[model samples]
Target: MKVTSAIIAAMCLVSLNLGYGAFYVLWSIADQAAVARSEAGGGFDPSQLLPYGNVMWVLAQLLLLAILVLDVVAIVLAIATWAGRRNVGRAAPSMPTAAPGR
Candidate 1:
């Protein structure tokens, strides 16, 4: 049904928004930390790069989680729609039919 489809689309959009928000916040925090670390050390050390890498790893995991959640929602919607249609079909057979000709 159109309603179910709309709901699924909305859920996907929300998940995307969450993912974007997570990435933006995490990246900003990591950037600030890396800058501070470099400043305190008076030079950029290779070890100082770990914060960025860790942030990237966390973002990747969160993105994957978002994707998994979206997929599960879509599948549940599809199954619900299919079951709805099946129930409607089963009920249709019991309904009275008008005579072919008046």
Candidate 2:
């Protein structure tokens, strides 16, 4: 792939990671707060009402795994692009130019 394309791809990957990370942090905080408030109430334990919080946490972990995989792929692609550029720069000319007159 062209160097320009690779740069663009890297930028996009970084943007996506930042967006997902921000949202994940916000959601995690909100979820934790809700759990705390529920536990503090005098009524029955809130966990019993939402036993699936653990499941949700597991799902969130899977989302994190996906983001990590994407980051690794992006880094590898960027490195490959740099390697390709270096190889191209170092390669010797394959053919000599012909004379203007025979």
Candidate 3:
């Protein structure tokens, strides 16, 4: 038996939401740390205080963004696929296969 469409959609949404939340939390860490360090009256550079440099932080931020985008798209595609499979079973018809009949 297959899962209900609503369940599939919900699962996708949960996965997507959690992924985005994680990405956001990871992304904010650097900015927050930088702000904390800079509050020392600008007497020192935040990058110097950081265990990781600005470049590494920014790269990590971008990587998280990329993962967020990919996961969001995967969520959408998974929901679509589940719905399609439910609406039409194996009888739904597959893409044209290479054959002499074609």
Candidate 4:
């Protein structure tokens, strides 16, 4: 139970980091696009931001996917952990009590 909980926590942390990375990449891409537009001075040629822009976009998408997968795994593990605890509690044998006047 403890181990499962630990694993879930780790996955959540990793997911958070991935989320931050994805956000940063997306923000960078938008900033770059804005700069390109401003530099164009009237005609914004998106082609000017070709391969590099595509690569960054792909990277951001992958990071987002990773975050989604990690979060799903963490949620599954948490549910399993809860079920395991519930089963253990139900299966545990209670001690017998003494008579009231004993």
Best by TM-score: 2
List the candidates ranked by lDDT, beginning with the highest.
2, 4, 1, 3
The numbered model that scores best in lDDT is 2
Alpha-carbon lDDT of model 4: 0.75
Q: What RMSD does model 3 have?
A: 7.5
lDDT of 1 by residue, 1-102 (tens): 888877878787777868777876787688778767867876667666554676676877787687778768877987997788789846455777799986
In terms of TM-score, which candidate is stronger, 1 or 3? 1
Q: Which pairs of residues have clashing backbones in candidate 2?
A: none
lDDT of each: 0.74, 0.77, 0.69, 0.75
Which regions of candidate 2 deviate over 4 angstroms? 47-52, 92-102
User: What does candidate 1 score in Cα RMSD to the true structure?
Assistant: 8.5
Question: Which candidate, 2 or 4, would have the higher lDDT against the true structure?
Answer: 2
Clashing pairs in 4: none
Error of 2 at 61 (Å): 0.9
Which residue pairs come into collision in candidate 3?
none
